[model samples]
Target: MNPRNRNILIAAIVVIVVVVAGIIGVTSHKKSSANSKTVNIGIMTSTKQDDAIWKVVSKTAKDKYGITLKFTHFTDYTQPNKALQNGSIDLDAFQHYAFLNEWNQANKTDLVSIGDTMISPIHIYSSKYKDVKDIPDNATVAVPNDASNESRALYVLKSAGLIKLDVSGDALATPKDVTENPKHLVIKELDAAQTARALDSVAASVVNFNYATAAKLPENQSIYAEPINKDSAQWINLIAAKKSEKNNKIYKEVVKAYETAATKKAIKEQYPTGGELPAWGLKLK
Candidate 1:
């Protein structure tokens, strides 16, 4: 109880208090850091079907992968790529190889595919006629205006025997490539997303799968549907990221999250009623 002993005891108590405070601060910081990291993904269209798939993927990412994945919805097929290029999103999942190649050439950006998603076949649907042969001569037909989709539309039309595309034209075929239009059909190029609406006005229109589903077209009942197979490799959909993030471990995991058999089931189930088919893409570990 003397003055020297009393001062020593007080100094010891102050040091203990400071040490305890430092420990608490460190523990709190660690907890905050462990919560997880956030990542944003860009997608073409937001639908209840996609929402279901996202719900499962988002929960799995947070619980098992320590990533908080958020999706930014876009109406235009062209928007997702631009968003990825400008760094507005961490990644995007709304394009195929042909479209990717065309965009890269057209825009001077270096986006690359991280993984594959699905192949939704493009088909020509006719609300006015029961068959392609029934289409009147000189009738107007609508096709997606985007270079990749336009070429696809042309292929479908050629397959119908209404026109003949020169062998050299192939996937790059344009309206001018038509060497013989037996029906003299008019090819009206419109935005890919608008082709379905154009069906009501044109004799027939080539519609992309997602847009067809969105427009509620009868794809299963369409007059002509593109066959799904290895031959359609160029139309296979993919998950894309900036060229710089191709090898990033975290982004790689995000890409793998969609490769699960369960995710594939969810994707296919989305179109149970019609308009789209799921292309379970490559499983890249």
Candidate 2:
């Protein structure tokens, strides 16, 4: 063979070998990646912006444990658990013990709490009155009409000296349950989601913290907010998974990633008042 022709043939062979080796390396990396686990979880936050913490949590979980996280966001409270139960997602990080307990009883599902999140308290806000005492005796106060928060709002009002309940310390008090109206106060019932926006129409309205964030109501404007530790364990929000997944290692890492200080700050920044008390360090008992 001619010397130049032989040299050209050798170069072609070397090129083919290099290309095949590169393809094998790429294929191996993809196979290794595909072998790792990815977790899909649902969260019902106030809005998409409030879903920011999942980004940080996802990054950390992926880096530390070769885990991939897919977050499904929900603005509605009733949807997360349904999505979880139907296998739309593997887990969810929404609702507290009381809400979950009620949901499980009503739906006959065995969902359970895996870990705690922060407690976002219910608050009463007044556009007209700064001090609860300064309000007119008969001033209309708005409360959430839903059974759960209506009771909570009444207790908040009772604690503020605004009204007296038939059961003074009842956690499930309703308007009819008000035994005494010293000021002849008319309790206006509105949808739970609307209570924050109804401030201009009523003397004051009790707002859920999530709805308060949605309405952009500053926490400073609150006439009263439920104290963090004062509230029962029923009020403590949590990360939930199927009772079947209680021992899931990946799901546990997802909770660990979310409970970090960085994720706590992320939760706080989503609200105007820097958010509620962190329940990360709290025990289940």
Candidate 3:
């Protein structure tokens, strides 16, 4: 073969190799990108405040697991779980085990917890009285009316030594379950959101952490706080979804992204008053 013809043939082969290599590289890049997707999460938060912890977790999810966190807020407590069940959202982070069980029993939905989130300890707040023991007899004290929270509030009152419950074990105790009210205090049941507002009129009100925070109530002023323990284990917050999707890989990844050191730090920083505490195998300070 002539020298010019040999050189042309070599150049043509090089160009074809470069084109084939470019196509393969593009295809691989696209496939990797496809692994990344968005996950919609329903959150029932009282405050519209910017969530710093979620921001950190979301960044980690995107950078590491290729999942983007999209949060949808709801004012009503009953909405998130229902939304998750009906396929309106991918997952939800709100209710604790007790609350979830009550919801499941009532609605006949079998949503399962995917991972532990944080336990927002229930608190008894009083503007009029400095201590639980200071409240006068027959004084009105408000508590959340929802089945799960109402029972939890009653237990908190019992823990404060003001009341006694007739039931034991996992059975939720209500105001009627109060075998003894030494003070004969009037237990006024109100919506969880209204408990904070009723603080002015009532001797003391049992308020959820989120509702207390939303009302800008000082945490230090709380007369009594429910201790986190074996009894309160059911109150530990968690991420939940339809029971059928309990073992989904991407959902598991989302949980891993959230239950991290970074997210834990953010929770502490965001809730300096310790109203919210991480529940996933972390020691409480």
The TM-score, computed over Cα atoms with residue i paired to residue i, of candidate 1 is 0.80
- Candidate 1 per-residue lDDT, tens place, 60-139, comes to 77777888998899988779999998899999988888889888888998899988777776777898888888889999
- Model 1 steric clash pairs: none
lDDT of 2 by residue, 1-285 (tens): 999999999999999999999999999999988777888888865366455667777887887777898878888889999999998998887787767887888899999998887777787898888888877878888888867677778878887888887854424577887877788888999998889888998888888877887788975688877765444567788888889999888888777887888877777776546456678776543
Residues 1-285, model 3: lDDT tens digits: 999999999999999999999999999999878776889999976343237778888998998898989999998888999899999999999889999998888999999999998988889999988899999999999999988899989889988999988977677778778899889999998988899999889899999987887798986669898987766787888999899999999999999998999888888888787778889984443
Global lDDT of each candidate:
0.80, 0.80, 0.88
TM-score of each: 0.80, 0.77, 0.84
- What TM-score would candidate 3 get against the native? 0.84
Off by over 4 Å in 3: 1-34, 45-50, 282-285
Which consecutive 10 residues in model 3 have the weakest lDDT in total? Answer: 44-53
What count of clashes does model 2 give?
A: 0
